[model samples]
Target: GITLSGGQRQRLAIARALAVDPRILILDDATASVDATTEARIRLGLREAMKGRTTLIIAHRLSTIALADEIVVLDDGRIAARGTHDDLLETSVVYRDIYEHGLLERQFADAVEARGGRQPLEAAS
Candidate 1:
C-alpha cells in the first residue's frame, strides 16, 4: 500500500485535473497543502496551464488568486464584493481581513524560518 501525504495528494490531483484539459477549471485551495515556496512554483506553472482557459480559483491565500481577472469576496455564504485584487482591497472589508491575515502569517513564517525555527504549522508533506 502507498500512503501519500497531503501535498503529494494535492499535486497528484492537480496533475490529473490538468491532464483532462477542461474548458473551465475550478480549483479550491489547490495550493493550500504546499509551502509558500512550492506554492509560488506551482502558481507559475498554473499561470501557464491556465492561459486561454477560464479558471475559478477558490483560495484564502491572496497570492493564489492575485492574478485573477475578477475576484469575488464572500461573507456568510453570500457575495459581499466583486472586483480585482486591488479593487477589493479598497472596497471589501472581508477581502482586506483575509489579505491582512495572510500577510501576517507569511511574515511570521518567514521570521521563524530566518531564526532556524520551523513554521508553527508545517507544510503538508
Candidate 2:
C-alpha cells in the first residue's frame, strides 16, 4: 500500500470503518485535514458507499458538513441547534458563525483568484 498523508489517513479510516458493513458510521471531524478538492472527492465516494448505511458526521468545517442530511450544532456541551443548512443558518448563531467563516474563506479564495492568482499580500503596497 502507498504511504498516506494525515488527510489521506483520515479518509482511509472512514473507508475502513465503512468496510465493516456497518449499519451506522460516526465520523468525528473526519475531513478536518483534507483540502476542499480532496474532501469533495471523499464525500462523493461516501455518498455511494453510504446508500444503505447511516452516517453521523462531526465537523467544524461547515463546507464539508453542509452535505449532511441534517446538522446538529453543539455549544458548551449542549445541543445549540439541529436542522438542515438553511434552517440552522436561520436559527442558530453558532452554526451561522461556522458557516460564515467558511463562506468568507471561499470568498477570499475567489477574490485572490480574481486577481490573476496573485495574493494580495504579494502585491506591492
- Score residue 53 of candidate 2 by CA lDDT: 77
Spell out the clash pairs found in candidate 2: none
RMSD, one per candidate, in order: 4.7, 2.5
How well is each residue in 27-104 modelled by candidate 2, as lDDT tens digits? Answer: 888888997789888878877877887888888887667767888889999999999999999999999998888888
Residue 22 local lDDT, model 2: 91
TM-score of 2: 0.82
Error of 1 at 17 (Å): 0.5
